[model samples]
Target: MTDFISLRNISKCYSAAGRSVFALKDLSLDIRENEFLAVVGRSGSGKTTLLRILASLEEPTAGEMRFRGKLCSPGNPLPSGMVFQDARLMPWLSALENIIFAFPPRERTAELHEAAKKMLETVGLSGCERSMPRELSGGMAQRVALGRALIKNPSVILLDEPLGALDYFTRRAMQRELIRIYLQEKKSFIMVTHDVGEALRMGTRVIVLGEGQMRKEINVDFSYPRPRSDPRFQRLIDEVLDAIGDGE
Candidate 1:
């Protein structure tokens, strides 16, 4: 497939104490449509920085990004949805209202309410639309956040540790749910996670980053619901850990 989104020699730098900090250094990547691309690395390895740049939340200090074929910047960000570690739901809004909030005020009609209701069902929250964020469980709240992102129907979805705060069981369940959603929506998904195993399970392709540069790229050819005990899966984990300099 041709590149759906392309980043060419992208770099991001920050200034602290009159000194420069390089978050990403000359990184280039291509994302294809209908694929799950997982990014893995240690803290400060630029995984989140790259996702931010892709989301157009941050501008690259150098280089450029092209979506489809046109250049994109902070002023003209890509058409995409983003989910962070925290659900970041509005405490005052019900689950249904939170999703309706994705639309502009003028667009929030009765029809829109029906659409949001469908979205809640899509995220497996059909009966909980009346619940507040505080009332929902961590996974359910994150599902609401996912629903909010999906309601807009963007071509790409950017996930930054969206399941990081959930318990082990919930996290695993969310991982499966994410895989299901990615396949059902047939959209490009760029997810950044610290867990090598999670990356292996969820990504069609995994990119390992170190020191703000691409260390390795691994293609996961197996089907979804991959067995963790499989030798191939374990080997891929080892390879990614080695790429991240953690396999020693």
Candidate 2:
């Protein structure tokens, strides 16, 4: 359980209306190998900013990150894939094509199609390979997006509210799908979500953020398909809600 990725004194700032705005402040975290880490907070809590920094989509204003003991920055980021709330698939591409689109054109070998097909199966969408984005259900389209990320064979996967668009049952199903993929791929999965229960159910460890800093950390310390009715589970949820300043 070594550190796969480490952030040291990370910070992000911007100037708005002639005033400095800090999106993240002295936020430090260590992501371990094969662990599912969930980040929870209310709006403007810096959750998405943290994920963006990890993905190299945004550079931190201060501090640094290390991946596998090597320094990482926007120019030298961790080998990772990112999935957004929207599937963001090309409107004209089929499921198979969407997964293959992850690679650059020159890297799109005949072998890549087979790999994409395998990834589709991995995400539980084997027979829907030829289905167009418009033809797939919300969950199915999101699964294709997941396959697109997994096909890259990244060391870590960053999820930014990827299931927020789904209905209740679909969201639950996707949660299980995500866990299954996490175990099977053995890669670090870092997700940002507003749902406290969702974080408690899926994360091996949960980190709570408020006003750009971590307020609390909790360990699930149990097996998957977490029992929501268990008193321990309820208690942890309560603790997390309180940490987020929403407990009443």
Candidate 3:
């Protein structure tokens, strides 16, 4: 099977205050089709930069990126949808409208509306569609953002700390919801997160970034609904943390 996403010796640098700073260093990775891959790392570890490169939101100073065997060039349209850390919704628009904003105005408007409604329901935000972003809770707004992404029906989804702002309970719930969506939709998911447990719970493979490089890759061979207290899970977390030089 062809790899859904491939990054070959990718590197990125930025000029700041007349000096060049490297954000990524010769990074290479492959994400298989229909796989849920989580990228975990400390602040400034290049996790977000990696996602941006994969999504074509940012350009790499060196190397190549491809999606589904096609070369990814600058300004190349992303084959995937994205959900950021913030909901990034149009505060002026209702939840439904924000979702519909991406759809082209054509004869299929009604069909798109129905599709958006179903996506909202899939994300467990059924009755709240008519509410504006200001009226909705943070979790609800994020759910709407997720719904918007899913409504695109892209082959891949890039999540940049999408659940980071939620409270513990909501975050846990969203983790389960993400897994369900991945299983039901069978779409490729690549997520950047700092939460180790979240990565372990939702990702079939976890890639650890550290010091501007891909440091480690781990596979969670265990089944879904993995227990945090499970000895193997805790052991894997410790190993990852240690790999990143985090003692705790």
Candidate 4:
């Protein structure tokens, strides 16, 4: 199948005290439909930058990014949603309100309310409609964030260090939740994570980056609920580690 999204020689630069610093240089990627792509790299390796560029939160300083062969820009944003390490939920709003917040003021009608309510249920936070951000646990709050993003009915979902803040148990649970959501939603998911195990567990394809460049791309042919105990699984992890120089 053809690529759903393409980034051709994309580069991003930052000006620091009149000094040009490159966050990403000559990075290229092709994202397909219904894919779970995981990006792993050390800090300053531009994993987050890549995700931001895909989310339309940041622009590439050079080269081009296209969704379905059309240039991506503010006027023509990608059909996608983004989540971050922090849930960033509104303190004052309830769970349902937070989900509906994704829609424009003019479109947040009774119908959207029903849709938002359904979305809350979709993320497994049904009865938490009236729960405030402060009232919910870390996992529940993140669920609300996911709802906000998914309520847009986006074709792709970009996540940056999602589940990084949760406890180990919550993180594992959320991982399962993510898989369930992905299987049901059938949306492309691009996640930037520091956890190799997490990436192996969720990603259908894993890309390793170093010094703002693509170092390797590994295909994970295994099924969902990946067999971490399998020898092939360990081999892939070791290979990714080697590519990342994490073995050191």
Per-candidate Cα lDDT values, in order, are: 0.93, 0.92, 0.87, 0.91
Tell me how far candidate 1 lies from the true structure as C-alpha RMSD in angstroms.
1.1
Off by over 4 Å in 4: none
Candidate 4, 1-248: lDDT as tens digits: 35589999999999999899898999988998999999999999999999888887888899888898899997788988888899999898999999988887976677898999899999999899999999999999889999999998999999999899999999999999999999999999999998988998999999999988999999999898887898889999999999999775
lDDT per residue for candidate 2 within 12-126, as digits (tens), equals 9989999998989999888888889999999999999999999999999999999998999667888988899999999899999999999989877878988898999999999
Q: Against the true structure, what is each candidate's TM-score?
A: 0.97, 0.97, 0.95, 0.97
Cα error, residue 155 of model 1, in Å, equals: 0.4
In order, how many clashes per candidate?
Answer: 0, 0, 0, 0
lDDT of 2 at 55: 92
Residue 123 in candidate 4, Cα distance off native in Å: 0.8
Give a tens-digit lDDT track for model 3, residues 48-71.
999888778898999998887888
Model 3: CA > 4 A from native: 104-108
**Candidate numbers, best lDDT first, in rank order:** 1, 2, 4, 3
The total number of steric clashes, by the backbone 3 Å criterion, in model 2 comes to: 0
